[model samples]
Target: MLIVGLTGGIGTGKSTVSKVLRDAGFPVVDADVVAREVVEPGTHTLEKIKLTFGPDIIKNGALDRHKLGDIVFSNNTELARLNAIMQPVINSAMVDKIAFWRAQKVPVLIIDVPLLFERGYENNDYIDKVVVVTTSPQVQLERVKARDNLDETKAQNRINSQMPLADKIARADYLLDNNGDISFLEEQIKNLMTELKGIAPKYGTK
Candidate 1:
């Protein structure tokens, strides 16, 4: 399996691009999905979180994502603490899924990870390339604020919490511009997937 790692800062339309790839019939392992999975109601990961961060972050026996986000979004230290707790469990689950697919003889796979660069997936043999979706800082700020129903300050804090978009772009094997309209993004994705098909013909069939 040829694993293509996808990442982008908050509000950069990485999820949308991931959908396009899946729509094109490629297998995609979404890290965000596994992050939620690892911390579900009865999991040891969630138990650890409750023990470490206190029980308040849980509501109705489930992780209160919003409550936790409110706690960590503004404080870099708290965010790091949360990442340290969650990342390993999430990565382990993701690795298992990738292994399952590879054993099934999947021709290529897409691993959508928002923190691909930060967590150092660059060193992973499975990831053949890294794609970063990006747009202007102002646009990102506005989009994040609108999408998350956050004020400018809170939204900016969330954006600042991630590795900078510029740094991600610099490290990218493929950089995509999400600074334009959806049609433009769709066109760009189509062209990019066409190129990908050439590189990995077995999985590129659409």
Candidate 2:
């Protein structure tokens, strides 16, 4: 299987690309989805998080994601602490998913991780390529504000919390520019899928 890492900043339309892949029958293991699963109520991960971030972050026997986001998004130290607690479990889950897909002999596997480079997944031996989706800063900021219902400053803070889009683009083996309409973005993804199809067959032979 060809292991491809798909990543982008907060509002660069990475989710749209992942959806496109999914609709086209590609299996995408989204880190954000796995992250939520690992921290579900009664899980050890959630217990550790409650202890670390305090019990207030939990409500109705579940982790209050908004409360936790507010605490960490404005503070880098708190964010790092949260990541330290979450990354290991999330990574393990993602690895298990990948193993399952590989065993099924899927031609291509896309891991939609927001922080692929930040967490060093790009350097993993199994990752065959990195695709970074990006758009202009203005477009990204607007999208973030509208999608998250945040003011400009808060939206910018969310964007600032991640590795910059430029840095991610610099490291990309494939780049999808999402500055235009959905049709344009879809076209780019279609081209990328075509290329990946050609490369997938020979991915592990070497």
Candidate 3:
């Protein structure tokens, strides 16, 4: 199967594109969803996290993501520490999902990872293509602020926490501009799907 890594900075419409791909019948393994799964109430990963960051970050029986986000997003050291604990598990889960899809004989499989480059998934030999979704910095800031209900500085901080969009675009095999409305974005995705289908066969036999 042609394994595609789909990524974008926070509030860059990566989820929207993933949804479109899902609607069009492609299998998409979302890293955020897998991240949550790996840290569920009784998991070893959650125990390690609690040990590392303390138990206050857990609410009821689950990891309080917002609480953890508040802690890590402001502190690079803390964020790196968290990534150190989580990335290996997440990567393993993603690889398992890709193998599952390949065994099912799918032509293309999309791995929706927000930190694809940050976590080094781009360098993986199995990843056939990397698609980065982008938007103007102003639009990105506004969307992040509105979606997460944060002030300008906090939203900007969240945006700054990731690798820069310009750097991601420079490394992209494909780019999806999300500056316009959903229809515009969908049209681009339609064209992208055509190209992906054409390329998938070349890698599917691997």
Candidate 4:
């Protein structure tokens, strides 16, 4: 299988691109979805999280993500600690899912990892391509602010917390500019899928 690592900063439409890739018949292993899955009620990871952050992070027998997000986003140490608790579980699950796709002879597998470069995940040899979705900083700020109900400074801070969009684009084997209309974005993805399928099969077969 061809493992394509897809990444972008918040509000860059990474999820939107992932969905298009899914529609193109590629198996997508979404990290955010997997992260939420690992912390679902009755999981050991949830127990560990409760132990680490205490009871207030949970509410009504489910992980209160907003409450935890409020805490971690404001504190770098706490954010790192939360990542320590979650990354291993997420990575392991990703590995298993990728292996299953390969065994099933899937031609392409998109790993929708938001923090692919930020968290030092570039060294993974299985990633046949890196596709970075990008948008202008101003547009990103506007989108995130509206979506998250955050002020300008907070939205900028969140954007700054990730690796710069320029750097991601430079590192990417493919680029998807998402600053345009949805139809334009869809057209770009369609072109990319064609290009990727041609090279992806050659590498995976070798």
- Residue 146, candidate 2: Cα error in Å is 0.7
- Model 3, global lDDT: 0.93
Per-residue lDDT of 1-206 in model 3, one digit per residue for the tens?
A: 88899999899999999999999999999999999899999999999999999989889989998889888999999999998999899989988888888899999999999999988888899888999999999999999999999999989989999999999999999999999999999999999999999988888578
The list of candidate 3 runs beyond 4 A from truth reads none
What pairs collide in candidate 4? none
Candidate 4 has its poorest 10 consecutive residues by lDDT at 197-206
lDDT of each: 0.88, 0.94, 0.93, 0.89
Provide the lDDT at 69 for model 2. Answer: 88
Spell out the clash pairs found in candidate 1: none
Q: Give each model a TM-score.
A: 0.95, 0.98, 0.98, 0.95
- What would the per-residue lDDT of candidate 2 be over residues 26-125, giving only the tens digit for each residue? 9999999999999998899999999999999999999999899888999999999999999999989998999999888899999999989989999888
Residue 98 Cα positional deviation in candidate 3, in Å, after optimal superposition: 0.9
**How does candidate 1 fare on TM-score?**
0.95
The runs of at least 3 residues in candidate 1 whose Cα sits more than 4 Å from the true structure, single-residue gaps closed, are: 201-206
Q: How many backbone clashes does candidate 1 have?
A: 0
- Candidate 1 lDDT over residue span 68-158, tens digit each: 9988998888888898899888878988999888777767688999889888887877788888999999999999999999999999988
Residue 101 in candidate 4 has what lDDT?
89
TM-score, cand. 4 vs. native: 0.95
